[model samples]
Target: MENNRYNNFWRRLAPSVGLFFLAPLVGEYLLGNISIKDIWALPFLAPMYGGGALLIREVTRRAGRGWPTLILLGIAYGLLEAGLIDQSLFNPSFEDHVLQDVAYIPALGVSAYNALAFIVGHAVWSIGTPIAIIETLVPARRTTPWLGKVGLLVTAVMYIAGSVFVFRDLQREEQFLASTPQLIVVSTMAVALIGISFAVGRKPQPKIDRQTPNPWIVGTLSFVISSLFFGATENWVGVAFKLLLLALMTAVIIRWSRCQGWGIPHRLALAGGALMTYAWGGFVLTILLGRSETIHLVGNAIFAFGAIVLLIIAARKTHDM
Candidate 1:
């Protein structure tokens, strides 16, 4: 009985563990923001990215919520990371990026373009994509809560600790803190989003009679759309275009998801497409950052290859389901 119980515990915790590491791997390293030489930072990043992802997933699943709720929570996570932890959204000179130079909104003390990019990037890629991929890999436990009460407490504590560590480190290094009003606005927005997620989740999903598109087509479209979304220039026109694309993608996905034909394959394809985008896009980003070193390129190749393999395995698993 003791052995059996131990096995069950690990079985239940496996997905959580996957998300714990996969979140940071996809969010930072796979995106080429952190080079291979800095792989040591993964442990530091895992607490915030992985812990947040686990917390978001556990809360959404335990509440019997779905993707909409998860995505909303992801946006809230993005807001917290940008506005509070790292203050990148408000820090004009963050890592010498000079983010606020373009599409700067004086009243808000933020760059409108960067705000959209960071928030949406985190929502869709950092949190949402990793959750989708892991859940796809373990379909049996997809909607079930993976962590127990103790686990939840630990995750929360880790997230808080990680966030505070990053916040303090960045504050000391940059000597920057967002204004009180800016902090207040960000906090308010995050709270509102969290509230809205639960409210939206409570509503019954509407069924549509229309036939869903083929999974291959869906995957292709997702790849193209996500590619375009991330490739947008850092300007007002790019911001407007991204917003339009987001609205259209949201509408289409919602409509198709409501249809009876939508299933695990479609979901997997959507995630796979987006995953592929980052796989190749990482190379481009490395080049753009003028870090086209052999090590960086080699790292990008390894990560991109791993992504493709993972997607293939996921596709096969999804088909078996």
Candidate 2:
């Protein structure tokens, strides 16, 4: 029985696992190894790739028994590539190539290895955590989180060991790191928010009753908090929004963490909260959290697209669920 169930598990896993790594793999196959131009493909596809599954779920819900919407999602996947890509860095000159070859990669001197490590690590955690939660929450074929936990824990342990290498290179990376105060503030806040997310991962939360949203105070606060993000735009508001979003996420996280108890589908909301938190973290970190003027240049492309995609999915799901 166990062996048969394990076979069924692999059946479900195969497609998603393919979809997950397949995005990057296909990009490389067509283009060649990751390059500055090709890798810019990272930010755009990263969100959609994972969100694609949810996107499929949403479209199917709306279409009501049809593969047509699923086909549409495939086309939209191209829009993700069409959206924006900065290929300026492909300078693969002697110096750039040398730097990469010498056990290094960097986003402004912080270490390329470190950034890649984080991306790969997050890719693993964010992708699996949601599916595991869904497995447990879905009305049928639910799997225990302990099964998920054991896998996640083993992978996390390996990632951490590699992170030790990053810590050692932190100082070496400092030379390429931003010297500006704003960038420092933003990156610091980003690290903190990610840390909180690490703690919140995949733990089932108590559902916030959708019908009785206690929106009285919390909803108002959510709106206010969201507006703070908007206002920060006009006035160099990186740090403020970063902190506010974190606080907001933290609050909702506590409420939703009891989803198993509340009988509400908090994943939609928690996904919203997670998206909000990580989206802001990515924004803040873009130019060292809030320092570099270059942020505006790349900002709208990555964050805006991800937000629009997320908000659309969230609104539709909330209405349906």
Candidate 3:
């Protein structure tokens, strides 16, 4: 009985553990925002990125919600990270990057291009994509809650503590804080998005008579579109184009997902495609940032290879399912 109980506990904990590590790995490391040299900081990053992902997943699943709800919450998490925790949304010089120089919005005190990139990037890559991949790996528990009440509470506390730690550390280093009006606006927008998520999730998906596309096609399109999204220049034209692309992509996905043929393989393919974009995009970013150090290049290659291996595993698991 004790052995059975132990096995069950580990089984239940496995998905959460997968997500806890995968979130930061995909979000930070694979994206080349932090290279091998900075790997030491992962322990610090895991709580905020991984813990937040776990909490968001648990809450959505517990509420009998789905991807729509989780994606919105991911955006909310992005807002809190940029606008509140790191204040990167308002910081003109964050990490020596002139974030506000391009497409600056004076009224909002943020770069329009960056605002879209950071928020949407966090939503899709940092949160939604990792959850999708992990759930695909554990198809049996894809829609089920993985955590008990105590686990949920612990995740929440860890996320909060991580956020506080980042916030204070950045505050001291940057010595910058967003204005009251900016803070209020960001807070309100985040809350509104969260509320809208539940409302939108409650609405049933529209039935589609059309057949879903082949998984390969779906994956290719996802890869191309996501690459375009990240590869766009930091200008008003790029921003406008990305917004249009975002709307179209959202509409198309919503329609495709409603088809009866849409299943685990298709979902996994979509995620895998996006994941690959970051895998390669990391190299481009490194070159652009002029960090052409051999170590950084090698690190990007290693991370990209790891992403490929993970996708292969996910594909095999999906096939078995």
Candidate 4:
């Protein structure tokens, strides 16, 4: 009985924990900011990031879908974060991000580059990475809902409350976009994205001739490509070029996966590859950017290394499975 209770406790808590850390790990720490130094931030961050991931993962899995659906939900989460909650998508100047005129749509007040990068960043790193790692860690539970209806309701409330807090804070910084029409359009699009995800996720994926690649190769390519992509964000030209490369690689992967050789290992490898980019790059950029103190930088580096090791282990386990 005690064992069952302990198991239930961990089961109840692990998903939240995984999601809480993952948001900062991938979104803040790995991407650039070492918000780990700010203990005061976790309360708000936890609800916003953790709740978003948990809700999406549970909803998609409960719907009997897989990564593709999760990816769609991820895109929705991205839109929510960048568009509604933080309004970074519409912010003319966010964090020294000079995206106002980079393919800016005057009517929409949206920058094509910023929208794409932010959305993809949240989709791939913030949402996708954690889900892949957690699912890989416990493959048996991959398809199950981690939260019940009550739990989900609580999570949704927490997420909304967190968003309100963030939106208020952003407004204080004068970074808030107050366009109601834009808000309506983006919110409608977010809803549409979620609907599309559920609709597509309900369909069965077609069987194909799987051509699985070496997990290491997949990880390496993902690392190199994703690293280049992240690095290119420094300039508009690089961003455009890398976006093209990203599209090309994605197309190739999808086509290749249609073959029978594609399996669990390949999927994990692809995830690991994307994650490895941030793992190593996080350390180097943290130092170069001087975003944190020496101690914080060193601590973040250690964590990054640990993450890479764990991801590698997970990749191996996924391959073996």
| Model 4 per-residue lDDT tens digits across residues 1-321 | 999999999877786677766765676666555545664576667788777888888888787787778888899889988988888888887755555777777888988777877898888888888777777877777778887789889989988888788888878886557499988988898999988887774655576755666767877787788877777754467658778877887786766566676766766777788877877766776767666577667657666776778777786677566
Every model's TM-score: 0.97, 0.36, 0.97, 0.88
Candidate 4: stretches off by over 4 Å: 233-236, 283-292
* Reference-based TM-score, model 3: 0.97
If ranked by lDDT, best first, what sequence of candidates would result? 1, 3, 4, 2
Residue 105 local lDDT, model 1: 97
Worst 10 residues of 2 by lDDT: 81-90
List the candidate 2 regions with Cα displacement exceeding 4 Å: 1-143, 146-153, 175-211, 214-223, 226-267, 273-303, 310-321
Give each model's whole-structure lDDT: 0.91, 0.37, 0.91, 0.76
Ten contiguous residues minimizing lDDT sum, candidate 1: 201-210
What's the lDDT of the predicted structure labeled candidate 2? 0.37
Candidate 4, after superposition: displacement of residue 220 in Å? Answer: 1.8
Q: Residue 178 in model 3: shift from native, Å? A: 0.8
lDDT of 3 by residue, 201-272 (tens): 686777678889999999998999999999888899999988987898888889899997898898888888
Clashing pairs in 3: none
Residue-wise C-alpha lDDT for candidate 2, range 22-82, written one tens digit per residue? 3332222111223323455554443344444333333333334222233233333322211
Colliding pairs, model 4: 209-259, 209-260, 210-259, 210-260, 210-261, 210-262, 211-261, 211-262, 212-261
- Cα lDDT for residue 207, candidate 4: 60
